[model samples]
Target chain A: MRLSERELVSLIRRKLARSTASEGTIVGPGDDAAIIAPTPGEALALSTDAIVEDVHFRRRWATGFLLGLKSLLSSISDIFAMGARPRACLVSLGLSTWASPLFVEDLFEGMLKAAGRFGASIVGGNITRSNKLFIDMTVTGHLAPGNAITRAGAKVGDAIYVTGHLGGAALAAKHLFGGRIDRGRLAEVESFLRDDVAATPGDAQVELLSRFFAPPIRAEESSALAAAGICTSMIDISDGIGSDLREVCHESGVGAVIEIDSIPVFDRLPGSLAINRRDMLRLAISGGEDYELLFTVRQSDELRLQRLFQENDLCPITKIGRITPNSEGIVFLDNDGRPSEGFTGFDHFSTKEEGH
Target chain B: MRLSERELVSLIRRKLARSTASEGTIVGPGDDAAIIAPTPGEALALSTDAIVEDVHFRRRWATGFLLGLKSLLSSISDIFAMGARPRACLVSLGLSTWASPLFVEDLFEGMLKAAGRFGASIVGGNITRSNKLFIDMTVTGHLAPGNAITRAGAKVGDAIYVTGHLGGAALAAKHLFGGRIDRGRLAEVESFLRDDVAATPGDAQVELLSRFFAPPIRAEESSALAAAGICTSMIDISDGIGSDLREVCHESGVGAVIEIDSIPVFDRLPGSLAINRRDMLRLAISGGEDYELLFTVRQSDELRLQRLFQENDLCPITKIGRITPNSEGIVFLDNDGRPSEGFTGFDHFSTKEEGH
Candidate 1:
């Protein structure tokens, strides 16, 4: 059932139960502005993103509730990618004049649903008028003296790994475009996708698909990995492996020679997903919005990482490349040992002509 | 004249000379993921807004640099409105293909300039491809104990006051629509608008416009306002006096009786300005995005508030309204003692049709 914006806000409030705001939460929600405590040494993390009507999704493809959920997830995902647990998320919505208060409520419901799952609360946000339905969210997280992680931590010879499979979201996008659903086929596909719903033992394909649609991961894993002394540098694989990896490499002042053959790809997948084997590498390399953690570890720590994965039943850690001096730049080497041409992973600006 | 995104980012980084995630900045910038500390018992004040192409601005009216600056200001303004000092900000930009790295950088330049003024730092953000220009930002602030202010704090018999004058931005916006540079009259306009640029008087009007388009007035004044024990409740007039006051009253579970004539309106603006008095009042009441503080003082604290203003050389605080029982709701009475039928306040969603 579709939820109303008010209902959604209530749900989000429920999830925000964990945030105490230190007895300084003079006003939490249900107000135009929320009151908070001010600390001299403390700093805040602020960020915003918009999910446009046609650009981000189709109204007919998903309920307003789902769209709302995705909108919250999209920005919160950025917060998570920053390696901070979400403390609060504020939304500024743009709605069509014809939209009812209920529609907005449903959008909030979707957002609250997602937010509830992540322990973040919606403190305060704005609703603006617009010709289109736009969902924009800004999230804040707290990081004390030495807890936050950044992209420049990778060291030379650090092992690279990912939390989930690469292309299932892309596959889901294809299925969404076709608007066809077969439970029987879906179940079979789920076996390969492993949606991380409960983690019933299935083949790698179901796990991969599940990972793509809903990557099973959290910030807790970063702590776990950190406690194990395994991660050297890290990133969330929102864009495919290549693009995301390139980010880590570039920021860390390292160049990597990745073996194409080492990349994990789903071959037993059905339903005619767009990326082929060659393109699969590309998708794994560049398809954005994965939300899986991608990190590098010193080669010496690989054993510890493997043990953590074994104990946690998280996705396997793979060694794809190493961090080298920036003098080498970032290069993708094939199995035969040659450099490839044309490696612009994704540019939001350059693709405007194609309408995103 | 425009700056590149990279160059802009570099400039912004330069502007934020002291902002270091150093002690706890695990993940600064240029990373797919940033990690931060999660301090317990601290509720966060978070807000997000988007300044979209065509929706929020006219490219010709505002430079790419100003657009960037405004985007950052909008986010920071939310933080200030909460009476919270900014900690960190995240930006997610969807750029049109026509925009170059230079153009993106210029936008960042504007944002950095604003950020520098407020001491807020850009910690992390994203870049993506889109058909239109979209700048989304989230700002998070920390509030210390007993310092956070909320609209719900207002009590019955409380007096209403605002930080700056109203309607000037609306007037400026109207004049801007003509797009004719009256260079000969520029000096007059600049001097007249001097309050907005912080070159002259520190009254409601000047404070209002400055808060609208520039870095927020932080720390000392707020601390002084709190220390002097004047405000019963406070809110930044992001929306105009009418709507913002409505929010304060509604949240406080009280109704308000506003004196239409008593509300401060900008005067001696300009001969060519050609703005109507009622229109100016309407703009002051209905026009959004002022970002000035709207606060209430208990009757007992009125003298203190006056002394505070006198001490600061600020404009005298005008008594525009009174908080009443909720049963009365919001009532705006004019000089003739007639009841108004409608209020033209801005609802982000409702105002979509207003040609903002």
Candidate 2:
């Protein structure tokens, strides 16, 4: 049934309900905030995300169920990226006045699916009338003592490597935009978008596609990489290599040089929208929504790191760049021996006026 | 210096940088989510509230500093009202992309001042381009062992009491809106609005006007009132007596009979508004932005409650209503002995389409 945003909010409030003594909730909705006590000694890692309806998802994208899953997955991936286990999440859903009950329910169903998959609970949130459809998730997770990984640890001499293939998610998104897909084709696309492919699996080409949709590396890998004393600074190649690597340089107080020929790119992928292999590199470099981990390890451990990944049947590793002084900024050496001046990446909300 | 929303967001992000230590923060920003670990046993409390540009605050009612304080106070008030001590806060600021840096700074100053008053730290937030000014604060508060307070615990026949005076904050708000005060009049206004002016000392009324701009209620009061074994259920009167009480009754599965004459309306209250005295009752019942506590107590402990509040010099305790079966819903007992339907309260984002 069609429902106003107010009605949807009221329904959510009733369904979520207040916490009882048995629920271990000290404060629940209808208060200034909900409160919970953490198990002692654990440091909290906090994250917040805003999802604009049209920009982030399409009404025709899969079902409301898939849309919910993808929107939530987009946020959960951040928790996974932090190497922290998911804990409690507060979801703020902004419903335009004209939303429908079925639509809202389907969205919740999607969210529940993702929440269950990640083992996180929806603890508290605010539901209010909004001009646009916006869902913002404030996810809080705890870190085991000293297990949290950051982007600052990569050393200058460490070899730069990335996990997974990097263009399929964008491709999947493109396909969704183009129009309807058959069930079998959609299923294949779904599997391809899962977070594990690029994070693990050593087939160099398979891993190349993995980076495009979902990256698989976790804090455990960082622990393993760091424990072995093989890695220095690290970053996730989210906004493509060029944009993300720029952040690593800015954060680590260093610059970098990426050898275009050495950078991994997926080839021979079959999809409705066909493009040149050169464009794939550009997508790999500037095409975003890729969640792959990029890191720097000692040059000496380069061979060891490659062997480790290959032994685990993951993608073959590549040495794509070396960290340099800030004075170098970020220089990209193309296959033609041409150095590019600037990098381009996606800014989804930047182009719009802001209310999503 | 004047700054845009982007500049403001950058400042906030810089402030929060020191709070996070997670290595797994692959894509913190410029992406869909800030990925991180779900640390074990740590429960996260997420809360969000939005304040519109004009409805919530006047662009010139107070300094940008004070506006920021009000924004933070309004949101953080939710955390404290839950009996949870706030730990960190995330703000999603949606202002006209053209807002000046000075305006943004003023907002931050207000927010930081309020945070300092409550001992809560500002951690993370987002900034987006928007056509109108919208500041949404999502706060995470840490509840002590088994100590979160909700609005559902009111037992049958519990006496109701409100901390501080009612209507004074509303008075202060009205004064600020008319914009008649001069610079030298600040001290006079502050003195007149001081907490001591309430019929009783230590009443929240006088101080509330000052706090109206920023209501200061400690988390300790929850325990103090709870320890007295008098409060059955409680809520902060944000949307005025009538509406908030309706909420308390609805949550507790009961109804209430409010006496029109019994509600503590303010002295020297201006008559400038188009609405009349009866409408004033409507305002007291429904007008919002007042953060005074409304709580229920055992009938047997009514005397003790009065004495306790008196000892603390709190405003005169008044019993405006009593809880009845839900079938009664919420009724107002007029001097003519007629019962009126429910009162309308403020909904900040309500627009012409709502037909309120």
Candidate 3:
């Protein structure tokens, strides 16, 4: 479900399985987000992504440091989803002619800060001249052997749990539409846009905007859970619960049922960002960029999970749904247990011109 | 030196030294093309490069499969330069809308073929929509303990040797100038380019073009030389002897003297690609992408190197130069043993839109 990828996915999956490069590769592509193994006792996870200007982000919307930090953080989110600890990263910068030395340094500063946070470093990378600024990043992480939580392991009776909150990044992004601003006024108008957004129900302008600027880091919690052998299936919520949830279900060959009333709408962080119940509900379900861990656990181990979180003082996790048979499909129940509609996730392809 | 890069180089070099994340790092940036260590007995080399449409290559000139092949071959060439055998690679594709699924599959075919040649495989990567097709690849290679042949080990009195021939790829490139072709006439005109090129000097259009498509494989020779401990320093001839030789001297605190007459002009492979003596000399010294290993051997090991190659039945290598004191600089001597002029390597930054 990364990039909501098409075509080449299945083709690469079938062809790459037979070709083993290393002696200790426990997992290859198609099922896991990465592939590698240092020893039979340990596994290495590698994932790569190319974030382009306008397509993924806009230079006018965030500082170079924030962009660099976010680029690395969002990429490593997959490593965490696979229940691994980030070790190193390689960044390929496609800089345009107008880019300056100071700007490049700022970009590195952001990446270094993020990498340092998780004991990761920028090992090596390449740079190229391109029409638009592109940050292509590859992150390598390590995990205990047999602990890789692929998206294909969820069982029908598993209880689904989501960590932290969601919907703030999507709301912050809504403030900026499909339009271009004056180049010189980019910085000044960015502040103005923040102020405009602050005038709305989301009074914590800085906090909400941060959701769009950087992804929430969850490696520690994820690794602990993985080491404890808890998660059945897992995926990072980059494209929201709706799109991401569908991915987990499809991969696991199962269906899910969500209790809408149990979902945390992410309002208490800074007060209600949602102006109405409908807006809040839709954002909670379909607004992407939460970067939280959406995972499944055995029904019998629910009490153990609660005790683990409490004992470890980990971030609060909520049981939002349960896994169901594949024929049942993904269902959402209202307070009256009735079905609902109007769920829409971010479509990267259609939003080609839109950047936030 | 990878891109004939600019300002940000030294800045990154100084900052990244203190930020070690892994416990097993034998080397880091500013010295080697890659950075990693799998165990005390073996090292893992990780290097990345981003090749963009038009900026690095032209879609109109070559088919997707060849582009993919060339892209991978060039990147892994760095691994061989560091005295390692490729084990795996992760490719991040930024696909433009015009790119079809068929084109992507062809790309994978090329990469898979190149990877399989060295027992390597395509492991994992991500794809995204972009304004142009960009392949950002990271190659991981392995080598014996303490066999790393970085560019910083050369000393005065070391003999310089180059693998295979030079200038054919550059000469073939000379047939292509800065120009655009009709989109629909691309495939037809590409054959025309080869035909037009064949009519002039290089009769082996297919062979000359192959030099530009797939880089000369030298991992076997490089690894053997490094394992034998005959090389004091080594580098791949990516940006021609002038630029790449300068890099070796600058890093090792030594200089070099190239015997112009000793350089094989790469004619015997399929016939002379160079038109005249002037173009021949210039192409041999300046036009890049030969991808041959340029290594320094101690004067004492010269006989041993000869015996090793002769005994192992390896590719022919020619000794074309000798290392000198730092004050000597990089000098080129003609047949009469006089200093020569008129050498200019490819400037990747200036020819931004000129794809070939």
True contacts kept of each: 0.32, 0.33, 0.32
Give the CAPRI rating of model 2: acceptable
Instruction: Quote the RMSD, in angstroms, for model 2.
Output: 6.3
Q: What tens digits encode model 3's per-residue C-alpha lDDT throughout A304-332? A: 89998899888889998999999999998
- Give lDDT tens digits, candidate 3, residues B130-162: 787899998876666467777878999999999
List the candidates' TM-scores in order.
0.82, 0.79, 0.82
Residues B1-356 of candidate 1 have per-residue lDDT tens digits of 14433444445455434443433444566544334332344544566667766656555555556567767876776665555666667777765656665666567766766666666667767654445567777666555445566777888899888765667665555554455534334333334332243344444333333333453344455556755556777876655776678778766888888888887876646455546788888877887665566788888888888888888886545788888889888888888987665565655433433335
Assess each model's interface with DockQ, reporting 2 decimals per model.
Answer: 0.33, 0.31, 0.17
Winner on DockQ between 1 and 3 is 1
- C-alpha local distance difference test of each model: 0.60, 0.59, 0.68
- Give the candidates in order of lDDT, highest first: 3, 1, 2
Number of clashing pairs, model 1? 70
Top candidate on lDDT is: 3
Task: Please write out the lDDT profile of model 2 over residues A10-119, one tens digit for every residue.
Answer: 66655444222213344554555666555467556676766655555545444545556555655665555545566666777665655566767766666655665655
Q: Pick by DockQ: which candidate is best?
A: 1
User: What's the true lDDT of residue A156 in model 3?
Assistant: 96
lDDT of 2 by residue, B274-312 (tens): 335675576577666667778887788788887877676
The digit string of per-residue lDDT tens for model 1 on A57-130 reads 55545455556665666666655555555656677766565556566655666666666667666777655445
* Selected candidate, larger DockQ, 2 vs 3: 2
iRMS per model in Å: 5.6, 5.0, 13.8
